[model samples]
Target: MSDFTQQPQNQHGSHQPYPGPYGGAPAPQPQPVRNGLGTAALVLGVIGALAGVIPLLFWVAGVLGVLALILGLSGRGRAKRGEAANKGVATAGAVLGLVAMILSVVGAVIVFKAASDVVEEVDKALDSASTAPKDPSTAESGAPAAEETPDGKPLAAGDASVYDDDLQVSVSAPKPVEAGEYAIGHTEGNKVYEVSIVVENGGKKAFASDSLAVSARAGAEGATAEEIFDGDTYGKGFTGTVLPGKKATVKYAFDAPADAKTLTVEVTPGFDYNPTQWELTL
Candidate 1:
């Protein structure tokens, strides 16, 4: 009788160790919950919040705020789901993102309102320009209309040149005179003439006669005639002021070439009045 104590033998079976407590491959370490989304959300939220205060950057702030809000919410959800470990950080990021969004909305409103006001002002200015009356003296070419005068001819002696609808200036016909032997501005071969300038003031304001000016040209060559100052016979320009409704007159002498056929005299009432001309046959 063979000993029947035969060890349990299996067909090509290898001996396996008995499982022990805490032996299974040391439960795979859960990868550290990546907090990348939460960190990114925090950073973006901070930037967006800072940009939200500037009016010109309102649009940029709005775009960044939207992105931050979406990212923050996503990160918060990830944290809540236990996919990320930074739950507090994610919540803070979401709060900041919400604040940034609110500020961006306010900034956008301010920017839009300012732009609207500027546009309205521009429109009003354009309307005013369009409705304003055109100046009657301005021609279609934007130049002042030509003034009608005595056919571009100088006024005759004794004819008044009206100014400001109140003042009248007239020049008398030239009277030939013999120059004194030692007269100041007379050439030996030239002739001298005396003329009178009369100014009638019809307006309420006194005319400043001290600023009056007189000049003369001789012959067809338009040579400047020399003024002759001979004792008290000829005075220098005008003096003082002409009272309203009064008349002022001054006599002047001019020396011209011996054979000059004509004399042209110009009278300026004052610095304010345009100079008027008178033509005289010599």
Candidate 2:
């Protein structure tokens, strides 16, 4: 035998290296755990994109797309250096995220445009309805002749003063005061007067009566007098909806100064109807 003993060899036919200080070959370094953020970003991006189709959820898609892009870049770097195992998946996630974001924006714009168009159409329909005229037969169904008199007559009491040729408007003389019953009662230094005005929808279309109003004054150039007080529920002076071929009668009352000798009444048709005036000597 030779002076030294033979040592065992590895498969490469070289002698085995000596063991580490305290153990067999040093434990292999553990690999860094694969970052799952890339996968998470991919999932979120898909979900966000779907929700983003709804106009209100577009913001969510943008956030997910950005996150996916960041994770994909990081994962690609790791993969190039042999640190991560899933480079292809990360890239796919990033690309999908970008596509979803673009789709979200486009979808939101389309939905908004459609809604706006619908609203515009509805507005047009309403405008036409409001401006259209009613049929002639309906509007002039019970037309009265125009009456012009210095002293007005009672309308409901069948003594009307003026009736328009087309019967679109009728004005009656001041009704006699029935102080204890229908008239404004117990004025110390004032006289109460009531009048009736009738408006017929002479046009084919229905119209709102928002523009009708009545007023009384001491004389042609006198100060406007106060309207007689009526409870909210009892007062319907010159305010209501009148349909095509329909008729509306408005009752108006005012208190004049006791010594006033002349009173003037003004009936203004709302919505561009010509105003009518009458002078009555008290």
- State model 2's lDDT: 0.62
Best model per lDDT: 1
Span of ten consecutive residues with least summed lDDT in model 1: 131-140
Q: Report the lDDT tens digits of candidate 2 across residue range 246-281.
A: 888877666777677766776666544445566666
lDDT by residue (tens digit), candidate 1, 12-64:
67544445777567677775687887787788778878888887776667777
RMSD score of candidate 1 (Å): 14.2
**lDDT (CA) for every model shown?**
0.77, 0.62
- Residue 71, model 2: lDDT of 79
**TM-score between candidate 2 and the true structure:** 0.44
Model 2 ranges off by over 4 Å? 1-142, 146-169, 178-186, 230-234, 238-240, 259-261, 268-282
For candidate 1, the lDDT comes to 0.77
